[model samples]
Target: MQTALNNPAIIRFLKSKFKSAGFIDGLKIRYRSLICPFISLIKMVQPGDSVGDVGCGSGQFMLLVSEFATPSYVYGIEISERLVKNANELFSTLPRG
Candidate 1:
């Protein structure tokens, strides 16, 4: 399947979501997405699944879950206030279903 990492539009959108992030942080997000097996992780989510993620930095995994799955609920916990804030901002941009 064509994951977000393979899709330019998705990658662009992800990067754009981090516009307020520092340059190094944005780069780190991009790099993490490329290396993580997000596709496999996404595939594990079934429709109506209530997903939870630990250490979900910037909510990237949760973001992909929103994109690729019809989960009833998604939650993410990150220690960094900055990352959690960024995750909230990014999620706010997603269209409500």
Candidate 2:
């Protein structure tokens, strides 16, 4: 099976999710997604599972889950209101299942 990281379309979609963000924030989000073991974490997510990410900066991991997995519910908490706002905006652009 092709992992989300290896799938160009998935990567493109993920990048597009951050297009409205500031350049530095977009870069940071992409960089964190690249460096973190999100793929491994993603693999553990079962379909219809409830996922939670604490300190989810811009909710990148949650976005990944929404794209790569079918979670019943996703919750994220961030200390930064700015990041939370950014995450909510990005999430709003996601296609409804």
Top-TM-score candidate index: 2
- Work out how many backbone clashes candidate 2 has: 0
Prediction 2 global C-alpha lDDT = 0.75
lDDT of 2 by residue, 1-97 (tens): 4345544545576677656668886666556656767777888988889999999877777987877877888989999999899789878876765
**Per-residue lDDT of 1-97 in model 1, one digit per residue for the tens?**
4344354545675676666768887776567656767667877888889999999887877887887677889989999999899788878867765
TM-scores for every candidate against the unseen true structure: 0.71, 0.76
Candidate 2 regions with alpha-carbon error over 4 angstroms = 1-10, 95-97
Candidate 1 wrong stretches, greater than 4 Å: 1-10, 95-97
lDDT of the structure predicted as candidate 1: 0.76
Looking at model 1, how many pairs of residues clash? 0
